[model samples]
Target: MPLTADLTSADLNEIRQSALGAADPLGVAADLAHSAEAGRLADPQDAGLALSLAAEIAESRSKFDAAQRYADAAVTAYGDRDDSPAAAARALRARILYRSGRADEANALVEPLRPLLTRYPDAAAYVTAALAVGGRARDAERWLTEAVQAVVAERGVTEPADADDAGVLFFLLQQRHRLRHALGLQHDTHDNLAERLETRLANANSGAAAAPATDLVFWPRAEFDRLAERTDAYGATWDEHRASLEQELVRQTAAGRTGLALLPGSVDALTAQAGIGGDPVSPENRAGYARALATGTARIAWPPERNGACWCGSGLKYKKCCLPRSRG
Candidate 1:
C-alpha cells in the first residue's frame, strides 16, 4: 500500500508513539523508511516531514546511519522552501554525529545556528548536549545561556506563545539542571530554571494526585510504596522522567488529546524491555523495578472537562467525541 500522505502532525505523532511502544522498533524503522519513499512519490512536502520523523525515530533507537539517510532525504524533499524544517533535519544529523563520537563535525553543523536559538530552542539544546558529550563544558554552558535567553525572550500572554515558551522552558530546565548539577556551582540562571521547574512539577503532581481514580491511574499509598523507587544515591531519575512526561503531556494537549500520552523510552520501559522477570506490583527489586514502572508506565489523564480535548489524540472536545452520550 502506498503510504498515507496528508497526515496531520497528530497522525505523525501517533505513528512515532506506536513505533516507540513497539517491542521491536526495528520493524517499525524499516516500515517508516518504506513509507517515506512511498510518501515521496505521492507528496514531497508530506514526504519530507515523514522522512524527518523517520530520522528522529531511527535516532531514538541509536540507528545513526538510518537516521542520517532519512534526514538527508528529508532535507532534499524540503529543498529551497522554509529552511527551518530542513535545518532541523540537519540538527538531527548533527545529534547522530555527536552521539557517534564525532564532536568536531557535530559542532561544525551546529555552530551556525547559534543566532537561531531564540527561535529553535531544540537546536540550541542539541548543540549544548553535543558539546557536553564532547567534554566541552564551557562551550555547552555558552549554548545553555543562549537557550535560557530564548525562553526569557518568549514571555507572553498569547496562548500559542505561552505554549511555545513552556516547551522551550522544559528543554532548557532539563539541560540547565544537568549542567548546573555537574558543575556544582549555583548560578542565577539555575535559580530561575529551578524555580520554574518546582512550580510546574508541583502543579503537575498535585493535579495527578488529586485527580479522580477514574480519571487517572492512581495507586494507593501502600501500592505506591510497594513499587516506588528509592536509592541511597542521589538519583534524579524521577526528575528526568518527570520532565519528559510533562513535555509529552504538553504535546498531547497541543494535539488536543484529553488523555495525555507518555513516551515509551522511559527508564521503566527500559527495565521492562530488559526481560527482568518480576511482578511489578511486588516489593522485590523495589527500587530498580519501580523506577522502570514510574518511567515507562502509561498514566492516563482525563481531560480537564468535557469541553476539553478527547483521549484519542483527535483535535476535538470530549463533548464532540468519546463521551458515552456523544458516542451514542
Candidate 2:
C-alpha cells in the first residue's frame, strides 16, 4: 500500500517532466483522467502535475473546449486552496479562451489577477498568460522583460553561461525578439541585445561548460535549407517572408544570438531583385545580390563585437551557429 513502492522513481520523474511540459490544459486533463481511472493517482503533487500538463497540452493543441475541463480538474485536485495554483489554473483557462479567438472573454477572466502581478512578479507563466489574453502587447513585453531580469538577478548571474539552461533562455530571447519586431522598431535597436546574448554564450564556453548532450534538441538541418529555398522563391508573399524570418529567429535564438533585423524594404522589391520566378540571378534582378548582402551583414556583425568567443568553445564566430543559413 506504500505509494513509493507502487511507483518507480523513473515513473515519477517522467510524470513530473510531462507535467512541466503541459503547455495546454486538455493534455493535462486527459493525463490525469487516465491516471485517476486507472486508480493510479497517488499524491496531491502527482495529481497537480497531471492537471497542469493536461491543461498545457490542450491549449497548445488548440482544444480549448477540452482544456477548460482539465483546468477545472487541476484546480480541484490542487484543492483550489493555494493562491498560486488557483491563479495558474485561471491562467490556463484564459489561454484556452484566447486561442479559441475569444480574446475579450479571456481578458475579462484574468483582469482580476492584475493585482497579483505586483506580488508574484517572477511568475512568468502567470504574467505571460495574463498579458497575452489581456490584449496588451506592450504591457506583456514589459512584464516578461522584467520577469527575466528578476530571474537573472536572483541567480546572481549576469549571463546564462550554462548550456543546460539554454532552452529556457532561448525562449526568453525569442519573446524579446517578438516584442521588438511587433513594435516595428528599427532593426538596429536590438544590436545591444544581440551582443549581450552572444557574450553570455561565449562566457559559458570559456568556462569549459558542457551542456548535457541529452538535453540538446537538434532540428533537422535540411529544414533550414528548405526554408532558405522557399524564401528565395520569386513572388514570395509577405507571409512567406514572415515565416522564414520567424524560423530563422527561432534558430538563432537557440544558438544564443537574439538579434534579428529585417531590412527596410517592400516584399515586391525583394522578389524583383532576387530573380525568384524562373528569372536567372542577374545584376538587373538583384535578388541574389540583396540576399547575399543581408547574409553577409548578419555574419559580419554577429557575436556583437562584445562576444569574444563561442559558447561551444569552438573558437568559431557566433554567426556560424547563431546567424541565418547564408545563401551567399
Who wins the TM-score comparison? Answer: 1
TM-score to native of every candidate shown: 0.50, 0.44
lDDT of 1: 0.54
**lDDT tens digits, residues 1-328, model 1?**
2235545556666776687777766666666667667663344456677787777788788788887788778767777663556566666667777777877887887777666665665666655665666677676676767666656667642222222346766666667666765775443434434443544455465664321111122333332333346321211333332332343355345544564432222335334644667433222232344344445556445433688875534457856644432211
Q: Give me candidate 2's TM-score against the actual structure.
A: 0.44
Tell me the tens digit of each residue's lDDT in model 2 across 1-328: 1233334335545655665454643444565556743557555355654665666666667666777777667666767554665666666667676767777877876766554543443344555755665566677766556545554555563334333554444445545555655665422212223333544566566863332211121112333233345333311433333333334344455755544443333334435555546433232233344444354432322233324543223355545533332221
Q: Single out the weakest 10-residue window by summed lDDT for candidate 2.
A: 211-220
- In candidate 2, position 300 carries an lDDT of 24
- RMSD of candidates 1 onward, in order: 15.8, 13.7
Error of 2 at 91 (Å): 1.9
Whole-model lDDT, model 2: 0.49
Backbone clash total for model 1 is 2
